[model samples]
Target: MKTTIAYLATATALVALATAAQAQDKKTLAIVVKGLDNPFFEQINLGCQKWMSENADSEYQCLYTGPASSADEAGEVQIVDDLLTSGVAAIAISPSNAPAMANRVREIAPDVPVMTIDADFLEADRDLRTTYLGTDNYLMGVKMAEEAAKLKPEGGTVCLQLGNVAADNINARAQGFRDTAGGAEGIERLAGEGGWTEIEGCPVFTNDQADLANQQMADTFIANPDLDAFILVGGWAQFAPQAYSQVTDQVMDKLNSKELIIIAGDTLPPQTQAFRDGRSHAQVGQRPFEMGYKAPDVMIQLIEGQTVEDPLYTGLDVCNQDDPGFCKDN
Candidate 1:
């Protein structure tokens, strides 16, 4: 009986040593968000780090990456290439340009799960990426249009300031906006009616530059002071302080009088607080936190040869000053 007990303890020790060895050989998972400056992407970073902390026992190493420029498709592609060469266990990315990124993901998807966040691959190459986890951007746009109509009940002229013209989300959002706010799409029409007119130099591309977006807004406002509402598809300039430099002091004051309606999509701490500070009428938020958090889990599951939800979706959380959840603990 003594010999049997000793043998059982020895086997258990061997198993424990093997487990430790495997634990040390963790697979590296890479998460690439949109831009370093964007707060929305920062939330994704939080999610990734949070997932790593909660699953401290797992054999996974998380790497979070962000680019300096939001419009740099080549830069995003290079990130994917670098991760692939470094032999990452899996990869999750927010593509700047879906059409540009489609081929790059094709090279790596067969070997690892190339989960996409925020935006997705083009229609033809949608199969390249393993799965997509993001908000229904079209519906988000519709929501924005709905809000715009509510504010300008008399019907007013509105212009949309767009960022990264190549981004899939931006395009879908524009179409959705047109469907409800700008033009007739034969839909149920939840928002603006014929009372709303779209400006010609409208949908001015900002390229996601802080100064440039501010300049565009300031210039457009100078040209069309009567511009009643603006649907900021992405809050590019609002992220930094320079965003205030270009707009004239008089124009900036209009936000308080409710003369101009500015509704933005994708809320982070800064943007939400900006809303709270009365920068805009309302903010429709995308769950980048969930995107960042779930991305790692999905990638790890793929690495472990397990099944995950195909095309996982994070949702939009909208709020105003009146809502209890309005930027709570932001």
Candidate 2:
């Protein structure tokens, strides 16, 4: 009886050791976004999952996580801090608050490879991350403004809608739009530059709240009946399809008449549908899937001590009612 018991105990010990070894063999490549609530990030998550699926035999596994709400900048920062100590082999972050994120990243000074996806740290603090993998946000804004210029050459009263006030990517896009449409670099507000004037109380900040974004648009139109163009540097309002549709419905007549040109960033399905429905004028989209798909490979390269390009651009997609072929269900 004693001999049998010893044999069983030794077998269990060996099994436990083997399981621990297996667990240690598998390293985690984590992608943390601003929020899990946004479908845009969900697309990124799907792409990350695709990479994991295609590399099922690999020892590295991809983990996708984020704050429950995009507005939770502190929550996102805390998550990054937690993941840094959680044995992740590498981390890819889409910062919700550029400055705050950079501060935290600097504090932690994580030993693992860190890169920014979708959004990046402000230029001053860019060294916090190894590289950025996402859209050329400035060019995206320039393209949107160019489309608006094409539709309304004389440039009229315009309003720019943006995401978080401190988000680096959104700021870059906003600056690009202002520079292109206003025809003057570094102009804060369009005061008749390039025949464009940004109305008072314009350039509303949404903080990534879809409902609030929709309300802000409605209020802007109500306030400025002569508002000529509305530019969204991010897809906050359009993410809430129903609310956005309703808000745009109130301005359909203007949209149809081309009196109010609404050019937005991101070509999400709902935004595309809005264009098809003649609610918005055009969409300038970033390749979120490509960002997610390519991030893992970049992380792997970093892990292997291989040099990768900084600020790797995924590319953009522009579509309009006249050019429907450019927009597809992403």
Candidate 3:
């Protein structure tokens, strides 16, 4: 009995050592987003998983992880810090708060390759990341503004909806919209420039909460009944299809008559359906799946000391009710 117990303990120790060795042999390529709850991020996660499955023979393993809540900026930073020391070979982050993430990245000064996906750091802090792989956010905003202009030739009162206040991508999109719609570069807000004026209590920040986003829209409409257009720099409200449908339903007549133009970001399934249902006018989408799919390869290249583009753009998809071909199948 004593001999058998000793033998079993030895076997367990050997197994544990083998498991540790196997784990160390495989390097992790992690893609960290703002939150896992958001479907937009989920699409990216799917693409990461696809890459992992296809490259099963490779020494690298892909990991998709993030905070439980999109609003948890600290959580995202903490995850990045943990991953930096946790045997991750490479990391691609979609920063929840640009400046905060930049600070963390700068502090860690990680030895491994680091890249930014979806949201990027502020321009001054761009050097912190090896590359940026995502949409040309400014151009997306410009496109959205163009769509709004097409619907309302002579610009009028408008409200801009955005995600996290400190997110660089969201800020870039806002800048693009303001610059285009106001007909001047670096125009912060439209007072009377280019016949456009942001309504009082305008440019509402949602903090990436779908419910709050929808409520803000409804409240804005109630307060400013004569508002001409509503622009969403991120698809916050529309992510919750049911709530969005209910809110937009109230203004269906205005949408149909083109009295209230609504142009939002991202052409997700539900957002596309919203366009079909006449809840929104146009959608300027970012290719998040493409970003996820390409991230692992890009990281591998970086790790191998191969040259890659600094800002590897994934491009955009423009969808509108008038342009059926542009819209994706729901």
Error of 2 at 288 (Å): 0.5
Inter-residue clash pairs, candidate 1: none
User: Could you tell which candidate, 1 or 2, scores higher by lDDT?
Assistant: 2
lDDT of prediction 3: 0.87
> Using lDDT as the measure, which candidate wins?
3
Candidate 2 Cα lDDT to native: 0.86
Q: Highest TM-score, which number? A: 3
Give the TM-score (vs. native) of candidate 2: 0.92
Candidate 3 weakest lDDT stretch, 10 residues: 2-11
* Residues 85-196 of candidate 1: C-alpha lDDT, one tens digit per residue: 6567788877887777777767555477777888876668777777788888888888888778777766688888887767888877777877877557753322446577
TM-score of each model, in listed order: 0.83, 0.92, 0.92
Q: Which ranges in model 1 have alpha carbons more than 4 Å from their true place?
A: 1-24, 107-109, 182-193, 245-248, 321-324
Over the stretch 1-330, how does candidate 2's per-residue lDDT look in tens digits? 543444344335434533553576877788888877788898898899899889988888777777777887877887788778655789999999989988988998899999999998999998878899999999998998899999999999999999888888998898898899887799788889989898898789998889999999999999998989999888889999999998988989999999999998888788888878887888998888888888899999999999899989999989876677666453
Q: Of the pair 1 and 3, which is ahead by TM-score?
A: 3
Over 4 Å off, model 3: 1-24
Between candidates 1 and 3, name the one with more favorable lDDT: 3
Candidate order (TM-score)? 3, 2, 1
Ranking by lDDT: 3, 2, 1
User: Per-model C-alpha lDDT, please?
Assistant: 0.73, 0.86, 0.87
